[model samples]
Target: MKCITRSLSCLILATVASVAVACSGADGADGAMGLPGADGEAGVKGDPGAAGENGDKGDPGTAAATEGTLTGTVTDAVLKDPLADVTVTVKDSGGATLGTPVKTGADGKFSVKAPVGTVVLKLTKTYYTDSADIMVGVIAGTTVSIAATMSEAATGAPTVTLAWTGDDFGYGKTATLTATASSPTGSTLTYAWANNTATKIGSVAAGTDPKTATATLPTLADATKLRTEGGVETQYVSAYKLPDRLEVLSIVPDTRGAVSVGVTVTDGRGQKATASASLNAASIQTGLRNVALGQRVYLNSGHDGTNAWTLTTKPAGSTATGRGGICSPPPRGGEYVRGGRESRRDSRGRSSAT
Candidate 1:
């Protein structure tokens, strides 16, 4: 029995030893891919996350501006002192108000803001003459400085009257111009004359009286007749009217169309007055003058009879000639003439008549 038990134990030990050796051996190579398994159950959906908190508030930002500043002073022109209690009206170049009107301080200084461009300041005060339009340019981000002067109201400014001795004056002729002055204050008066209509004037000499002067009229071309219809001719001429201010009238006679004379008189207290008058300019060469209503007159054809006749038509490349009337001269060589009608051929074989 003992022998049999020993054999059984030996067998068991051998089996155990074999199992341990197999477990401690190196790993074997991987086998071929296996068939895919069935899909498993789906997972549950997750809850949404919470939104982040709002950020902190930022600091305020500054805005850029496109405005500029203007400063100026108002002064009494004659007294050379600052003017107070004067109301200033600011206007754009087009005469539109810019802002609320500003007034001058006791020191005569003023300051205000305006859009970038030209601005005009008009000042008004009691007992003072209205100031002329003061213009100044304003720039962005900069200041413009100005000093203005205002004239005082005149109690009795010198009054002057101007007149031409004769309205009918021929072109390039001399005429007498007279000016009368009267000062309520008995202030002495001085005269300054100007030919406002003509581009250039002739010799101006003082006449016997201080207010009288003689001026050689400027020569002008004959008045142009635009058209003559039904015995009424339309002529181009110049004419001008007087103005409150002594505006210097300077323009071409042919363009503006009339002759006018101006005179300015000043008194002892530096007060000035002005007067203007129109002078009728007649055409001497054409024998043309202004006349009353329904006046009988002959029309000048502007032909001197010598070089004024023209041939309306003629045969090309042909020469012709003829004796002209008392004014038309004889035709040149290489010309054809027939019954006082003449045709002259030029170097280019063209013919023209006059």
Candidate 2:
């Protein structure tokens, strides 16, 4: 039995030595650490332990992402109706573009994401004035709602239609000019008349009608030229001078024959419209309306034994209103001179001509 026990003990000892070799070194000195193998399956859970006193407060952990949202609606300034297809943008304090511009949807409402801080919200559309810059405080984790109103820009180019009565313009004749202006907004209009060249003839200011102006045909510069060169009336009265005071009409190449009249119209908004027309002057009566009802026309001259022929009105033409026809000198004195030309100045300084 003792022999049997010793053999069993030996077997046990051998098994124990194999386990020790696998677990540790026999030299007793610690060996270099080996790479840790994968953790074994988690051990069975343990029961809760007694709670301990709090240690120390640790530093705060980094915060999660801080973001903001903007929700805004755009409307028309005048009509107060929602406006679509507008571009909404957010800008930093430095005026740098924050992200892509957000376009409004069909509802004229838009929402965009941005970093948390102070930002400017802007709304814009084609042919519209931008809304005033809006400063918004973009608090982290919050959405801001904004209302924007945009105004339509002043884009109306005014147009005008001008008309006038009395095509014929003779010395002492008058015509009326009218201007009608139209605009998209039905805005007020202003009227201005300028010559074709914009120079020489200068411009004329219309009457109070803002649309109506009266033009009085003035007489020729020289009375005698009426009989010679019937055309070539070139000079016009200065625009600054009063139309009422103007009596001398110049027949320039422009007015020498049938002509086109031109005028310009302007609106209160500073838009301009121009037009042109073919116009004919009235038949110019030879005699001045200045003569008395029945005054005889052009009779006397400084006759140095006479072979010189002087311009005299025919019997029927002797009146200031009569047709322009040449005849022999008036049989008697008491004749008068009128119209653009000077008749025989018999009384010198006392002699007056129209």
Candidate 3:
């Protein structure tokens, strides 16, 4: 009890002193505040905490990363099966290659940077023609998918055949030509029918467009005819028309030859093919050009001969002398003397005897 009383007395004395100091601060008169003290130094930095566990691997990146993506599958044209190992190359309109060519995987899937504007996609593979040349429009940052196709590579040169409407050909005559362009070896080709002689040989394969062309048959006429036309006064010879010179006005049995037909084909991949054939041309003639029925023994027949190959003499008009185109020239070894008389050529090569 005495000790407790002593502790209480001391606590009481401390409380009394605090109360007296508080009173003095409240009652204090106008005293100027002291200047602010200098700032103390900053505390030292603490050590860093231990690192946290690493995060899970980020989500797998997208299949393609570019301004635009072009993804597609390659397929076989005939088999209709997905094709692998096909190289897909892209080129700009100017023919400039865009980027590294992407190859189709086993799944026939491929992804690449899709070029903008008009662009071409070329697909190529072994033992196959690159028939997957596609033109595409790429939007910025857009993804496009496509299904490309391939054609089996041609094994041999292309085969072609040329046929005509008739067995013969003549000037001023129109004949239909069956210019068959074939791919016996399984090649792609286009048929161009132009200038009458040359035409494309097969249905257009992939990578080519359906081109429109004109098939015009060529007219036949010898340039020599123009020089000789003025001198001829015959009805058939004078009836020829202007520009008619090119027209085969008539089919003379003497004029006969062959017509050549050519054709051009393209593989659509910058490769070209050509073929040619010669057709034995003839005219439709039922009768002979310059022929006549004469007496079996007419030495002096009053007939203007057409041909000068034969000799017709009427005993040289009894004087054994005749002058004409055929007889005037006579024989190379002087005049012919049947009975010690001279024979001359008629207007034609033949000697007409009067």
Question: What's the ranking of the predictions by lDDT, best on top?
Answer: 1, 2, 3
TM-scores for all predictions:
0.32, 0.36, 0.28
* lDDT tens digits by residue: candidate 3, 160-258: 555555433332334444545555444567765433222211111211333322122223322012233467522121111222111223433322223
The list of candidate 3 runs beyond 4 A from truth reads 1-124, 128-159, 182-188, 194-255, 280-354
Candidate 2 lDDT tens digits, 1-354: 999999999999999999888886457778889999988998899999999999999999989768789998898765677778999888988889899999998788999988898898878777577888899988888899988887666665567777876554543445676767676645466666654432232224457876676554433222112221245222222121111122333333333322334667655445567776533333222224333332223211211111234344334544333223222223443444422343222334455433
Q: Worst 10-residue stretch by lDDT in candidate 3?
A: 293-302
Number of the top candidate by TM-score? 2
Tens digits of per-residue lDDT, candidate 1, 283-308, equal 21113334332211122232222223
CA shift of 168, model 3, Å: 2.3
- State the lDDT at 335 in candidate 3: 24
293 in model 2: Cα distance from truth in Å? 32
Per-candidate RMSD, Å = 28.5, 19.3, 18.1
Residue-pair clashes per candidate? 13, 13, 23
